[model samples]
Target chain A: MSNGYVFLSIAAMAVTTYLIRMLPMAIFRKKIENRWIKSFLYYVPYVVLSAMTFPAIFTSTGSVLGAASGCAVAIMLAYFDKGLLTVAIGAAAMAFIVQFAGM
Target chain B: MNLKEVKEGIKVGIPIALGYFAVSVAFGVSSVQSGVPFWGATLISLTNLTSAGQKAGVDVMAAGGSIFLIVLTTLIINMRYFLMGVSMSQKVEEKMPMWKRLLIAFGITDEIYAMSMSRSTHLTGSYMAGLIIPPIFGWTGGTLVGSVATGFMPSILAEAMGIALYGMFIAVIVPPSRRNGNVLLGVISAVILSVAFTYAPVLQIFSEWSVIIITVLVSAFMATFFPVKEGADNE
Candidate 1:
């Protein structure tokens, strides 16, 4: 909750992010070989987000049931290729309904 | 100065800026709800244009994560940018100076990189500037508005907005899983691992670093088994 800590944390995040972006430009002059490495890097985004979403999402709602209900809706909406806002609002509103219904 | 290219770049950047504007609002609301002060959230948005990384960073902070953990998590989540920067480096005009390369790399992002790569010719510094400037503004502006929005919005809606953060994360990971088996497998594996980490009493202690460790293990595991064919970068 301390502003100072949050600021420092954000600064660290910014520097780390900038370095990740800047390092290849600064040092990597050749095409990366090792298809395994390339493939691993390519899949990083999906895996990281996946791991972050699960378990975390289940606990993020007012109740576990609400989170689960909302999650089902999100899955269906996203499977249908709903936009970000649509999926977000859909899940949140559903969670709200579940919570309001005293589930 | 290639004013025409800059204008065109900005024009092309419009969609990206609008996207950033929308996404950053979610970030702002979440960060503030995560215990970040409004100004602190805005600053985070201003300095770190990373969507996933910034969100993850705030999540770590809200969890009372260590500085080292925050830095490492941010670095790992953002490692994709290294590949992006390398590809962008190859796309810039050959004579573009190293300093300019560094400057332009500051704006390297999924949207900016995509917009730049769509160009038939090499990108220039001015165009890169135009490409990033509005998105940056839109992102920061959205955060500014969102961080302060709790003052006006009802708590019920604010709580709903809280769930919206997870909604965004699901939105990002679920769609791709529908089409790509590798993505699907990676996601499914990570989900099972993460759920185990959360629910299993003995495994719960590893929760702090579980995501990062499992991400590496699952990704490398997928890459080894399901390597993408050469010349097709997911597309």
Candidate 2:
């Protein structure tokens, strides 16, 4: 793809992403009290995070073993109530070691 | 936005920014390696804070994908932002001006939305603004460094940083899930559905947007089958 195509793709993505994000804030004005909608909203964070993390995590670092090595450390540290930086960077470090070890 | 709220917002966002810097470094390397210029990568990160869409856009460009496909794929992959925005629309104080709300929407990533929403009190535009700044700079700055330093870093180090963002996502959810059974159930359900969606050949067609669909379905499932007491959110 040419440089123009790359810029064009970025523009397209930015506009679409911005509009999607803006629409919700632009439209919904009050607290949603409906049990179903409320519940759905409540769980959105966990659902989105888990959906994006799992399986995807196993492949994110270019190797399933490396990713899993990192993720296992992440879960343990996070379960022990580690800080975000510690758990996240620690996982990366562990993955780096695993990958460096030729895994 | 008061100075204090902005300070607190930056504080809450500091960890996110730290994580973003590490991850966007990977994004920088990937986009540049995929043939996107340094400035192009920087521009994408600045305008689109999305991790996947920005990275994937470069992938599409490298593969010679059509503009229509690029736009459509990003739209589908990023549809979750709409869900997040809708949810946040309710949480941010109704008194916040429309422009503030719109600007707040720009900073609504998975981590930001989760942190913003999970707070006990209503969000002000100032607070959200404070929250948004660090991650934006962290993301863009990392991309700039990564793209410029392409091939300068060892693959092992870069690979390690590659997974840090996912670890951040896990860190964000782990505490809440441990404290709240409803959250745990919702997470488990979403993970199960994600696995099913990934492996179930019939579900493969929705591959790109499966996360959005599964999230919506699992969230609704939690709401309907396992509603939690309202006070649970006060934490």
Q: Which runs in model 2 stand beyond 4 Å of their true positions?
A: A1-9, A20-27, B1-19, B30-40, B50-105, B108-134, B231-235
- Model 1 achieves a DockQ score of 0.67
Docking class of 2: medium
**Each model's number of backbone clashes?**
0, 0
Q: Name the candidate that leads on lDDT.
A: 1
Worst 10 residues of 1 chain A by lDDT: A55-64
List-wise, what DockQ does each model earn? Answer: 0.67, 0.58
**What local lDDT does model 1 show for residue B217?**
90
Best by DockQ: 1
Model 2 C-alpha lDDT per residue in residues B112-154, reported as the tens digit of each score: 9889987898998778877899999999999999888876777
Tens digit of per-residue lDDT, candidate 1, span A19-43: 8888888788677777887898889
What residue pairs clash in candidate 2, if any at all? none
lDDT per model vs. reference? 0.83, 0.79
